[model samples]
Structure formats: structure tokens, C-alpha cells
Target chain A: MGAVKQTLSLAVEQHARDRLARESEAQLHGMWVVIPAYNEGKMVGEVVANLVTLGLQVVVVDDGSADNTQAVAKSAGAIVLRHVTNRGQGAALQTGIDFVLGQKASVVVTFDADGQHSAEDIPALVATVRDEGADVALGSRFLGKMHGAGLGRTIFLRLSTFVSNRLSGLPLTDSHCGIRAISASALRDLRITQDGMAHASQLLYSIARHRLSWKEVPVTIRYTEYSRAKGQNVTQSLRILFDYFFHRSRGGQP
Target chain B: MIIRAVFLVLLALLTFYVFIQRRRLPFNLIVMSLIVVAAVAFILRPEMSDPIANYLGVGTGADLITYLIQVGLIFATVHYYTKFSTLQSEMTKVVRELALLQHKVERLTETEEQTGVGRDRGRAAS
Candidate 1:
């Protein structure tokens, strides 16, 4: 039994090394890091700086923020796109993805402007997409273990995971994590019609409809005081779930 | 009382004609069913019409029921018309955005073609 366990461990280590090598090649081809900001002027600059240090072409889409988010992000050496009006997060993400595709980026990575996502974990997501031959790599907070999540947030994540898994048949442990990396082909095919929180659910449905290969990797999510306060409460979460079903029933895009 | 029966029969015939002419079989069938029920009730127990009206809070005969039904149908028609108007406005916004994006793409393609021509001339000169 001990020898068998050692053999499995060795295989896992070899697989990890192979994945790292593939990610290095993807990085050399240039990955566009897209941060969708909406009134996150305070945190957007720091997020852009961190991504720039990681050698990724950073593009920050300011979704008609009522603050200086665009100016700060531009000052931080990131390309900034400003919306004329407040189109929701999904629209902002679509704009950034369109711009990145125009720039001929090989891989596009999405990060939240709230600073909850760590730029250091980007390579792991890119590696998962490249090595496993997956179209998209999603960062999962509840995959291996829960880290630094409050009780309320933990319950919300579990309920969302349950609903998403049942609906998409993907068995995802985290459905709403903003940290994800998609290949250029997948990004080009994605059509985001929903403008609000329902866009997240729409993306998963699109992936399933297209029969795209995807995987979830464990990653740490930082919840600062400001982020926790601004994050969706239980009431908002239920509303988003109801909106997803209502829109689906109306024959609207996910 | 005989005059009222004749009037109801004419109304039922007109409704059936409208349904058939419009090809609205489902709505026609529903209205026809209601007319049949009203006709049977009138024929079976004509004296009970006043009591049925009072039960419906109409305080009158079948005439009051006809008035109430007409008002309700009109209200529903107006409500649906307003809903259709709202949907038209939303569609206009979506079409405008699509047109803008298409124009942007066209300009970008034109610039690329122009650059390609310049590069070809430079290569030939070299």
C-alpha cells in the first residue's frame, strides 16, 4: 500500500511539472489580463499594478464608474475603456474581451477589480487551460478546502455551487468566482447578452451548450472589509438566482 | 324578454363570425363556450337571472353582467398594448448598439486594408 501511494504521488508531481512547462509557453505568446471595474477606483490601481508585474498585458474596462477608476488604472499603465453609461458587469467584460481579441491576445484572463483575486494565481489557471486542453479554466475557492471565508459567504457559495452543478451538469464547486482564464477561441465564440449578475450564469450555460472543455482549480480568495461590505448579501443572491430562472423561462440568454 | 333573447343570439353569431374570419380558433372557442352557457342558463331558469346577478354583486339582470365583461376586456386590451410599446423601445436600444459596433468594425478593416496596400508598395520599391 505504501509503494502504491508513492507511485501516485510521483505521477502527480510529474503532471504538475508538465503543466508548468505548457503555461510558460502560453505566457510567452502574451496573455491579456482583463479587469472589469465598476466604482472600484480604490482597488483598481493596485490590481493593475500587480498584473503588470506578472508580465501580462492588462486592460481595465471602467463600466461607467462614478469615481476615478479609469484615471487611476490608466495612470498605472493599463489600457482603460470607459462605458458611456452604466452597462452591467457582463457588458463590461464583453467589451474587455472584444478589445483583447482585437489585440491578438492568445489567452484572456479575467480578474475582479475589487482585489479579491490574486494575480500570482493567474499562471495556474492559464496552465490548467493549456495542459488539460480545456477552453476555459475557472478558479474554485471550495475545491480543495475553504480558506478565509466567513460562514455566510461559505453557505452562499455552497448553494450557488449546488444550483450551477444541477443546471449545467458540470459539477463546479464555485460558480461565481470572477477569476478565470479562457483561450482565444473560446473568448471569440462567447456571446454575452445578459448585462447584470445573470451574466455569470449565462457564461456557464454557454460553455455547456457549446460542449467546451473546462476545469476548476483551487485558489485562495481574499475578502477585505470593503469587499465584504460591497459583496452580494443573501437577499441579493436569491434575487440573482430567481432572475436567472426567469430570464431562462422567457427564452432570454442565460 | 323575447327581444333580449334575440339580441343575445345576434351577439353570439357576430362573435362566432369574428372568430372564424380572424382565424382565432382558440379565442373563438372560449367565447362560444361562454355564450352556450349563458344561453342554456337563460333558457332553463329565466326567473333565476335576477338572483344570479345579485350573487355576482351586480344588483341587476344579465345586462349588468354584459357591461362588466365588456369593461374588463377593454382594460386587458389596453394593458397588453402598453406592454408591446415598452418592448419596442427596448428593441430600438439594442439595434442602435449593434449598428455602432458594426460601423467601428468597418472602419478598422478599412484602415488595415490601407496599411496592407502601403506595405505592398514599400516591398515593391525595395
Candidate 2:
């Protein structure tokens, strides 16, 4: 009986040691950067390169781009998933999230492929999610002291913020920022059904539904001429609003 | 006259069948309401029915209107069915992609586990 007890105690100690080692390994696990690219072949490679330099695993979902986005992202050491048809930004993001979650990513960061999102801001967002106990960390351009946003874009973002806050009852300062970090739990639980630009609203609704804690940190979005041209226009903004309300009226959430 | 009577009975049967089929309630309601209105009109003014039937392209007024409405409803139903099928196809594509990605992740996790086990064995041997 004494021998058996000794053996059992040793086995328990070994199990505890193994658990500690696994926890340490998890702490060192890298972040997965998911970039949804739709014909931004020019900037995708650069974005992937920057994220790679930051020691993050990158996955680029090429949403049926007519350009060489898939080739460029693959060449840049990014796991590339190509959709056969042109799905919208929301669908592309869903694919990216699925890929990143598959990669066993401890944290997932969604960065725009249009070079608007600064790679330098990625670490800050990831740190916020890790250290602040936040389920998701959003990069907000309006929260911090930032400059160089066009008047039109600022107004549009404000309108979106107002609508999202009213609908979701979440105190979010910037609801439309593309740069965000989601914990593994949040990523696994998020069910993004929006197939178009209305995904921003969907994300907010999902966060509210899941009751995930989120924070918005100050980040800079460099709006280059190319990115500005490809960005959402006034008409697109109206269409997104229309789609959101239409889906809601049809008993669809987000 | 027998042919007309048979056609009227068939129309009444179709209208009754629409109501009996629970899945198409909204459609059945619209169709049955139209049929009831037409029936009431014919019963109220039997003389006007013959003139209206002559003006229409059919042998009888009730036959022409019923045929027209049925054709229109069938076309509309076909259009909605196509839309539903398209949505189903899109949803299937999304689900298939997600499943493929999930499988890839499972394989990756297995590989990682095997590698970790191998590393542990080597350390223990040393």
C-alpha cells in the first residue's frame, strides 16, 4: 500500500509539471494576424511582411481578387485562402478568422490589407487583449489625439458610431475601425453572417450578444491616396445602413 | 357546357388544395381571396358575365381571370424558389469552406502533438 501511494504521488507530480510546461508554452504562443484582402495585391505583400517581422503568424484571405493578391501573399510567407467568387469584405473576414482559429492562435488580429492599418499598431492591440483581460481590443482613430482625417470620413464614422452605440448599447468610441484584436474565445464564438460591408455592424452586435469585454485604443490609420480611393464612399455608407436595417427587419441579426 | 362545368370544378379544387397545403398559407390566402371575389361577382351579375367573357380572350370570364391569376402566381412562386435556392447554394459554399479549414486545423494540431511527444521522448532518453 505504501509503494502504491508513492507511485500515485509521483504520477500526480509529473502531471502537474506537464501542465505547467504546457501553460508556459501557451504563454509563448504567437498571435495570428488575419488580413482580408480584396484586390489589394499592391499592399498585401507589404502588410504580410510587416506582420511577419513582428513575429506574428499571418493569414491572408484573398476574396476572389482579380489581381495577384493570393500569389503575392503566398510569396510573402502568408497562409493564403482564395475564394473562387468575389465575396464581400465580411465573407473574407470570416474566412480569415476560420483560418487563424485553425492555426491555434492565442490571439487574432484583423488588419486591413489596404495599407491603411499600421502594422506598428498590432503589438499594442494584442497587448491590450492579453494584459487588459479584454475579450476584444479595437483600434480607434478617434479615441486618441490623432490628426489628418478628412471631414467627410470623420462625419461618416461619427454617424456609424452613433448608430452602433444606440443599437448595441455598447459604449464604443470607434465602431468601424478595421484594426482589432480578438481573443481565441471571442473568435471561436463570433458568428459573422454578414456577406457585405454591413459586417462592422454585425461585429458590434456579436460582441453585445456574447457579452465580451472590449476596449478601444488609440491607433493611426494612414489614408494613402490609393487606400482612400478604394475606401468606402458616401453611397457605400448609405447602402451599408440600408442593408443593416433591411436584414434586421427580415428577422436577421447583424 | 359540361366542359365549362368541369373547368369550374377543377378551379375550385385547386383553390381548396391551396388552403389545405399548410406550407403555402400566404399564397393560398391571396389566391383563395381572389377566387372568392370572382365567384361573388359572377353570382351577383350573371348577365354581365357573358359579355365580360366575350371581351376577354377566353370562352368565359371566370376561366380567363382564373387562368391569368394562376399563371402569374406560378411565375412569382418560381422566382422566389430560385432566390431561395441561390441563398442555399451560397450558404453551402460558406459552410464547406469553414469545414475544410477546420479539418486543416485538426491535422495541424495532430502534427504539433506528435512533434511535442517526440521532443519529450528525446529529453527523457537524455
Candidate 3:
């Protein structure tokens, strides 16, 4: 009876361990990280290497960068995809998403290649989709630690968030956060066509249109001098605004 | 009379060229056909434009024709602009797809060569 009791406890312990292993495996099994990069050759290698070390499959879509972004990303252990000419960030992202979806990835995460996003935040975002019932998990800088953002950028981000919130009606803390995780199911229901910075606003519009459940998680975004130099400036914001206006005027869907 | 004759000859030549290339440029043919029909109407019955112009708040028949030409020019400008934008969007899509495919092919070739080399090494070891 003593031996039998020991055996039974061992069996129970094995079952619990198996369940935990299966749960974690399921959490990461179909997760893919897509990075849309334009002229980010200088930083893409390190960015991709960082994500690869996290054990996530990474795909880098080089948006026709004149630099050696493709070679750098491939050398860093990423599946490198390229655009022949510079389609904007939105188009690059759509290409990456389409490619990953074809590979049967269940969860797709969009990470910026400017090295602004922390790879550490990815697990929680994936968990939000895998364990929780959320279809879209957006990483909000406002909710978490943010470094390197200046006063002017802060006001611009806040103003854009307010305007985008009113326009898209998502009403979250941050509207234009680049790091976002989307489920394959929600992605099927959504289509991105703006091919520009206005694509962020379009994403929120898609969320509202499809009525997909979404949640925000705190994420750290580093605004280094390199990233800031590569980032969109004031004139680009006006161009993005004009793009959204033109897109809305044309009935808004591709 | 000389101007009308020259105009009709030019219209005939345009119609012939458009019809010949109808399969490749169907939109151009349809547009040119409409313009030819309108020009023929004006040439045959110059009086018709006067009433049309008066209704459009112009004074004389020649004035009305001139106004109609301006309207046609504006319409053509808008039409071509729309066409140009659509073509530009299509071009972007094609370029993006081409880039992706080219990279994919290059990657596949490299993988094949690497595997081939590895296979040779394995045979030598055996």
C-alpha cells in the first residue's frame, strides 16, 4: 500500500507537469514576430538578434531600403522578406502578415525594427492572446516605462492619441503604439491598405469595424537618438493627416 | 470649310488608330469614339451648340462651343488624374510583390547550395 501510494502521487505529479508544459507550449507554438523596417539597416541586425534570442520566430520585411537591411536581418537569424521599391511601412507590414499567415501562424506580433521595443514584453502580450480571450493586444507606452521621449514628442503623441481615439473610437491610452499583437483570426477579418502612417488609425478603425476584443499591456519603448532621427517628424505627421483625409474621402477600404 | 474638313480627317485617323489598338487600349477607344461623335455633331450642325450654350448661361454659339471645350478639358484632366493615381497604386503593389519574390528565390537558392555542400561533406565522412 505504501508503494502504491507513492506511485499514485508520482503519476499525479507527472500529469500536472505535463499540463504545465503543454500550456506553455500552446502559448508559444504559433507565435510569430513581424518587423517592418525601412532604411533600418544599421539597427535591424541587433533588433532581430534580440527577438530571436527570446525564442520567437522573427520575420523582417525590408521596405526597399537602399541600405543592406536584408543582408543584416538574414545574418541575424531572421526570415528576411523584401519589397522591390519603397512601399510605405503599412504595405511592408501587410506583406509580412500575409507571409506569416500563409505559414499558419496563429498569433502575429508587429515589432518595430528601430530597437525601440523591448523583447521582454512579448511574452505577456502573447499570453493575453493565448490565455486570455483578447484578439488584439496593444502595447501602450503611456501605461508602462517610457524613456527618451521629449516634451514636444509627448504632446504630439497625446494629441494624436486624442484625435485618433475620437476618430477610431477605440478610446485607449495610446493610439499609435507600434508594438501590437494580433491573432490570426482577427487578422483575417482585418485588411490594412493605407500604406502609410495613417495605417495606425486604419488599424483602430478595423478594430471598431470588426468589433474585435482588445486590451492594452504596459510596454517600455526606448527613444534613442538613432530611433528619434529615423522617426517621423512634424511634416510627416501633417502628411499622415492628409493621407487619412484622402483615404476617408475615397471611402476608406482597399 | 477647310478647318471642318481637316477636323473630320483628323477624327477619322484617330478613330482608325483607336479601333486598331482597341484590344490593348479599350478605354482610349471608348473615349475617342465619344469625342469623335461630339465633334462630328458640332461640325455637321454648328447651330446645335448655340441653344445648348444659351441654356448653360453662355451668350453665342461659338462661345458655347468654347465653354464646352473647356468643360471637356477639365473632365479629361480629372479622368486622367484618377487613372494616374490608380496606376500608381497598382505599380506600388507590383513592385512590392516582385521584391518579396526575388528575395524568396535568392534565399531558396542559397539554402539549396548549402544543403548540397553539406551532403557532399557527409558522403566524404562516410
Candidate 4:
């Protein structure tokens, strides 16, 4: 009986040590942040610099920018990937995701490079995925301090969220939030093929389709004059709706 | 009468062109030949369609032809729309592949440069 107790104690001690080692190792594991940019050379440099300052690995996919977005992002210490043509945001994001997955990123975050997203919010997104056991941590503007969006824009966003929720069957406050963090395993199971603004809704559809564990975290969205001028407007909402339904009518192949 | 003869001649020429390209354009030949035969029958005998239209319960022969043309145009529109969408999807795929290839090449070059610099440092240390 003493021998059995001793052997069990030894195995328990070994298991405890292994768990501690894993926890410590996880503390040092960094995440990959992918910023899909299109002619945002004016702001991509600052965005990349801010993310790099936060000690996160950043990759900027310049979606065939007519300007010098690639050069600016690279000079800001970000890995620069360029599309041959303007394949839109969805294609740019998929390119960045595949590249980072190849590099073995533990967690992946999709960030916008239009200077609307705050780098400080990235940690919450990453922590939600890391510590909270969530497959996807989506950032919501409505849940956070939403500044600079007018009443018209706010109503449009809410209407879009309603439509997206109905289509995806998931109650999400903001469906078009450009900031989101996902685990490597969840990303491996996802295939984003919308190749346009409709990707935001498509992501929600995929989350519901794959039954991924998701949680919403409040994140600040700084909509500056420059960002607002360059950002998508009400017209794009219509286009996005059309694209989503068209993709669905085609058996959701996109 | 002269107009009818002119149409008949034009149809004959079209038939000849279709026959010459029959192997390469079998479906087009059959469709065009049918159209020509129908036009010839309509011009030669305007009263022939009355029985067919009556049998189909259409108001008149002219109305029946109009309805048939409308249906054909609608079908063509649907077919072209589907084709356009497929092409668009294919274009998106091609653009994505090209972007990925560009990224891969950049990564490969960066890796090669780093390795080359590492080799230089090792030689100096040795």
C-alpha cells in the first residue's frame, strides 16, 4: 500500500510540473496580427508601427495599392505582402492568414489598417482567445466607445447587424467590426472566399456554420476625419447585402 | 413579293455559311436552319400558324411568336448572368493565387538573405 501511494504521488508531481511548464511556455507565445490594407499608405505606416510597438507580429497585405502602401508598411517594421491586383479586402485577409499560419502563429488577429482600430484593444482580443477558451474573439463598436460615427451611420450599422444576425442566426451587435482574433485551429477550419466587403458577413456565417466558440469583447473604434473619409459608406452597405445574397444563392461557394 | 424573294435569298446564303461550318458549329447550324425554315414557312403561308396557335390557346399567331421570343430572351439573360458570375469567381481565385505567390517569393528572398548574412558571420567567427 505504501508503494502504491508513492508511485501515484510521483506521477501526480510529474503531471503538475508538465502543466506548469506549458503555462509558462504559453505566456511567451506571441500572436500574429494581419492588417489588410488598400491604398492606406497614409495611415498604414502608423498602424503597423503602433502594432509593432505593442510587441505583436504584424503583416500588412497591400491589396494592389496604386500608392506606396507596401513600402510604408515594410518600413514600419511589418512583413509586407502585395496582391497582383485589387482583389479586395477578403482576398487580402486570406492571404495574410495563410502566410501567418505557415509561420505557426498561435493566435491570429484581423486588423484594419485605416487607423480606425486601436492597438491597445488587441491584447483583449488575444487574451480572450488565450485565457477565456474562445475560438474567436470579435471586437464590437457598439459594446465599446464608438466615436465619430453620425446618427445615420449608427442606424445603418445597427440595421446591418440586424440583417446579418438574421442571415447568420447569431446575435451579434456589430457584424462589420474590422477587429477580430481567432485561434489557429479555428482558422484552419475556415475558408474565406468572399474576396470583398461581404467577407464580414461571411465570417459570421462561417462562425455559425463551423460552430466555433466565440465571445464578443468591447473595443474602441477611433473614426477620425481621415478614416471616415476613406471608410465605407451607406452605398457599400447595399453592395455588401447584394454580395452576401448572391454568394448564398450560388450555394455559398462565393 | 420582291421582299419575300430577298429574304429567301438571304436565308439561302445564311444556310450555305452554316453548312460550310457545320462540323465546327453543329448546334448553331441546326438552330439557324430551323429559323430559316420557319421564316420561309411563315412568309410562304401566313395562315399555317393559325391552327398551331389555336391548338396552343394563344390569342393570335403574332402574339404566340412574340411570347416565344420573350421566353427565349429571358433564358439567354439567365444563362449569361450565370456565366458572368462564374467568370467573376474564377477571376477572384486567380487574383488570390497570384497574391499568395508574390508573398511566397518575398518570403523566400528574405530567408535567403538572412541565411547568407548568417554564413558570413560564421565565417568571420571561424
Candidate 5:
């Protein structure tokens, strides 16, 4: 009887896994994940492969990387878009968003290509947009958990969050998480013009400006040695602030 | 007197340059002209800036001239920075368009290859 019970549990687990996979596949139909990669040749392939395994459509905008990021991402099964010259992360994201939206995607999710974000957290973000009817679902690392975040990085992210919250008035805990789910309709009203890391804050300001409904969802970020190395530093944060204020002063348009 | 004449000539050259660049520069033409005129007044009279300087809390015409030049420089810097940023954005848009167009071409080629191969297979099989 005990042996039979173990067999039944194994079959039940397998059935449950299959059902969840099918549900996620159905939910991810008409969904496209946009990953803006700049010289992330070492990591983008694995990241793209993981998403592809999850039955998610992915587009990697290779922002004029000197490395072989284009080839790696292509081999990993991403629809690759290559900018002829180096544009900032914002520009790359815009390119991917435009391409996928043109492909008639119903939902668009901007994900980081540096392998900091986990693929498992993506479904909840999409669900918030699709099922909860939120225009934008922002991934908040503070709301969830993050691993290997040193004290300095933690302080920087929190400080930037405070500043972005004051500037955007959206009451966000983590304003710079790269994972977000934006419905195609909300995207129609949105345009990212910051062309740099400052795009994070600009996206929030945009949400506030358009009066779009947004929900902050818990998402985990693994700050591995690589991501920690490529992560934003104090100088970059200062540049982001300068870009935000300067762009705001210029009326936030090109 | 020679110094003043040199200054006037230099200002004339700058004004001419600004006029020629009127099409490209974001500087307000009228504002730039006004600045050139004021600069000429300061260089010629050398004391006309005193009353204005006093009203503005600047000590003397020479000091006021320095401050005004600095302010003008700052404004020019800001204008050029904005212009540069706009040009960068325009370039980014062009690059983005090129990338998208390239992707479309690739997709078309891919589709053609698959269909062409499938058609050949069907004919061969028959």
C-alpha cells in the first residue's frame, strides 16, 4: 500500500507540473519578452534559453555590442535585433518593444539580459497585467527577496527609490527593477525616451503622467558576481539623476 | 582705443557667425542680437554698463561685463547640450529603424526559404 501511495504521489506531481506548464503557455501566448543587451555576450544566451524553455517569446535587442552577443542570443532562440550603433538601454528596449508590438503582441515585458532576473517571476507580472487589469505591472525587488546584494548596492537602490518616488509620486518601493509587464494598450500610450539608465525613473513618471493604473509585484533579483560587477555605481546613479533632471527641464522630449 | 576697436571687430565677427548659424543654432535670433548690441555698447562706452550693473548689484561695468559673459556662456552651454542630446536621440531613432527593417527582411527571407524548400519537397514527393 505504501509503495502504491508513492507511485500515486509521483503521478500527481507530474500531472500538476504538466498542467502548470500548459497554463503558463496559454497565458504567455501573445506575450513577448524584450531583453535589451549591451555586451552581455557571456550571459544573454542562458537568460534567453531559460525564457524560451518557458514557452515565452523573446526578442534580444543587441545594442551594438562589441562582443558576439547577437550570435549567442540568436542561437539561444531569440528574435535578434541589432542596433547599427550603440544606443542606450532605453533605446534598445524601445526597439524591441516596437518590433514585438508590430508583431501583434498583446503584452510586452521588459526584462534585463544580465541574468539578474529570474524567469519564474515573470508569470506573476503577466498575470497582474492580464488578469488584474493593471495597465503596468512593475517588479519590485524590495517587495520580494534578493540574494547576494551587498550593503552598498542595497543602499544605492534604496536611495534611488526614494528619489524616484519623490519625483514620480508613484509610491514605489523599488523603482529600478528591470522586469515589468506592460499591456499593448498601455504601451500605445507610452514611449521611453531617456535612452539610458535614467529610463527607469522616466517610465514611472510616464505612468504617473498618463494616469495609467500600475501595480507593484514582488520579484526576486539574484545579484551574482557578474551582475554585481555590471550593476550601477555611484557615478552612474549621479548620471541618471542628471539625465532625469535635464530631460525634465527640457520638457521631457527630444 | 585700439583695444576697443579690436573688441568691436571681434564682436562683429561673432555677430556675423551667429547670423550665418541662425538656421542651426537654437539661440533666439532676437535675443542674440540684443546681446551683441549690449556687448557693443559696453565695449564702446565702457561706462554705460555701470548704471545697469548697479541696478543689478554688480560692482562695476568691468565686473558686470564678466558676469554677463559668464551667464551667456552658461546659456550657450545649455543650448548646445540640448541640441547635442536631441541629435543623439535622432540618431538612436534612425538606428532603431534600421534594426527593425533588417529584422523584417530577415523574417521574409526565412519565410521564403522554408516555403521554397517545402514546395520543392512536395513536388519531389509527388
Candidate 6:
């Protein structure tokens, strides 16, 4: 019994050491931050710089932005991929994911190019995938806090979440939070085909259809004026619905 | 009579062009040809559609034709929209491949330069 306790204690100490070393290990290893940007030059550089300081490789898919998004992202230490034409956020995300996966990224964390999501949440989300065995760790603002979400935005987000849950048949508190960590295995099974804002819904639906294990880690979203200017509104829900019913292929394949 | 001649001529040209593009066009050739044939039949013998129109509870052959054209237009619209969306999705894939390829080449060149410099530095140190 004493020997068993000693072995367990040593295992706990080794786990602590691993957890402490994991940041640099994950950085040198295959943990990648994929930021899909289009006309987000004003914010992407800062976002990329912050993520890079965290010691993770950042890949930014510049979706044919009219601005200097490609230059700014590259200058900020991100491997910039260029789409000669704007293919929307979904396509950009898929592009970045494919690029990073080709680089043999073991885990990919997608963050918005707009400066809304907190960089601090990445470690915990990565832990959920690395240690807790979750195929995906979705960042949920409602599970944590929304710093500047107005009543209208908040209500719309909740409604969107409800609709997404109904459509995808997943009990998620959030649908389009724009920050999630997906294991390389889970990402290999899913592909983002919806080229518009509908990709968010498509992602949730794909997750459900693929039956990947997912956990919602609490993450904060700050609704800055910039983010609000760039974000989705309630009226866009009509277009999103059309995209869901019309754009999403049968069975969520590809 | 002049308007009838103009319509017939235009219809003839349309059918000719459709056959020329039958294999290349993204629409259904058989369906379009059948519609063109039906249109020519109605244009040539207007009274023939009256009986069919009356049986379908439409007021006149002209009204029935108008409704049928609307339905056909709607169907074509739906068909084209889906095709457009598919094209866009396929284009996304092509664009993604091009982007990834560009990135790969750029990285390869960067590494080549870095390694070249590394070799020089190692020689200098030795």
C-alpha cells in the first residue's frame, strides 16, 4: 500500500513537471494558432504579435484583403498565406487549418483576427485537448463573461446559440464564438466548406455529425467598437439561415 | 405579322445557339430543347394550347403560358443559384490550394537562405 502511494505521488510530481514544461514543448511541437484575416490589418498584427509572444506558431490566411493584412501579419511573426480573392472567413479558416495541418500541427487553435478574443484562454483550451482528451475545446463567452456585449448583441448571440444547438443537435452554450482548439485528428475528419459566415454553423453541425467529443471552456470576448463594426448582427441571421439550409451540403461532408 | 416573323427569327437563332452550346453550357440541354420545341409549337399554333389551358383551369392559353414561364424562370433561378454556390465552393478549394502552395514555396526559399547562411557561419567558426 505504501509503495502504491509513493508511485502515485511520483506520478503526480511528474505530471506537474510536464504541465510546467508543456508551454515551450507545445510551442516547439505542433500547437499552431491559425488566424484567418481579411481587411483586418489594423488588428491582426497586434493579435499575431500577442500570440507569438506566447511562443506558438501563428499562421494567418490573408483572404485577399484590400489592406496590407499580409504584410502586417508577416511582420508580426505569422506565416502568412494569401488567397488572391476574398473567400470569406470560413474559407480563410479552412485555408489556415490546411496549411498548419500540412506543417504537421498536432493541435490547431483558431482565433479571430479581430482583437476580441483573449490570448490568455489558449493555454487552458490547449490543456483540455492535450490532457483532458477532448477532441475539441470550444471557447464559450456565456460560460465565462462578455466584457462589452450589449443587451442586443447578447440576446442575439443567445438566440443564435439556441438556433445552432437546435440545428446541430449539440448542447452548446455558444456557436460562433470564433475561438476553439481542435485536435489534429478531429480537424482531419472535418472540413469547412461554407465560404461565408455560415461556416460557424457548419462547424457546429459538422462536430455533431462527426460525433467528436467536445468541451466548452469558458473564455472572455471583449466587444470592442472595432469588433462590433466587424461582427455579425441580428439581421444577418436571415442570410445565415439561407446559408445553412442552402449552402450546407447533405450529411456535413466536405 | 412582322412581330410574328421577328419572334420566329429570334426563337430560331436561340435554338441554333443552344445547340452550339449544348455540350458546353452548364444547363440541361434536353430540358431547354424541349422547352424551345414547345415554345415554337405554341407560337406556330396558338389555338392548340387553349384546350389544355382551359382543362388546367387557366383563363387563356396566353395566361397559362405566362404562369408556366414564371415557374420555369423560378426553377432556372434556383438551379443557377445552386450552381453558382457550388462554383464558389470549388473556387475556394482552388484558391486555398494556390495559397498553400505559395506559402510552401516561400518557406522553402526562406529555409534555403537560412541554411546557406548557417553553413557560412559554421565555416567561419571552424
Which numbered prediction scores highest in TM-score against the true structure? 6
Model 4, range A1-254, lDDT digits (tens) per residue?
99999999999999999998787457636589999999999999999999887667898989999999999999999998887788889988998998888888989999999999988898889899999989999999999989899988789889889988998899998888999999999997777878889988888889888999999999999888988887777788789888888878889643
Q: lDDT tens string, model 6, A1-254?
A: 99999999999999999897885775548899999898998999999999988778999999999999999999999999999999999999999999888889989999999999999999899889988999999999989889988888889989999988999999989888999999999998778888888888888888888899999999999989999999987678788888888765543442
Tell me the spans in candidate 6 whose CA falls farther than 4 Å from its real position.
A1-23, A26-28, A249-254, B22-34, B114-126
Question: What lDDT score belongs to each candidate, Candidate 1 first?
Answer: 0.78, 0.80, 0.87, 0.86, 0.92, 0.89
DockQ for each model = 0.05, 0.07, 0.40, 0.49, 0.73, 0.73
Deviating ranges (above 4 Å) for candidate 4? A1-30, B1-59, B111-126
Docking verdict class for candidate 3: acceptable
Tens digits of per-residue lDDT, candidate 2, A63-84, equal 8889999899989988887777
Better of 2 and 3 by lDDT: 3
Better of 3 and 6 by lDDT: 6
Models ranked on lDDT: 5, 6, 3, 4, 2, 1
Which residue pairs in candidate 1 collide? none
| Model 2: residue A65 alpha-carbon error in angstroms | 0.6
The per-residue C-alpha lDDT of model 4 at residue A218 equals 98
lDDT of 1 by residue, A115-221 (tens): 88888788889888877778999998877444467888899788887887777677788998889999999976676766667678888988988889899988778
Model 3 interface RMSD, in angstroms? 1.7
Error in Å for residue A68 of model 1: 0.5
* lDDT per residue as tens, model 2, B86-123: 59447746753964565477667778787874557657
How well does candidate 2 reproduce the true complex, by DockQ?
0.07
True contacts kept of each: 0.00, 0.00, 0.52, 0.84, 0.96, 0.96
Which one wins on lDDT?
5
Question: What would the per-residue lDDT of candidate 6 be over residues B1-126, giving only the tens digit for each residue?
Answer: 677678889999988887887466556777877888888888888888999999999999999999998998999999999788878888999999999889878877789797774557657888
TM-score of chain B of 3: 0.67
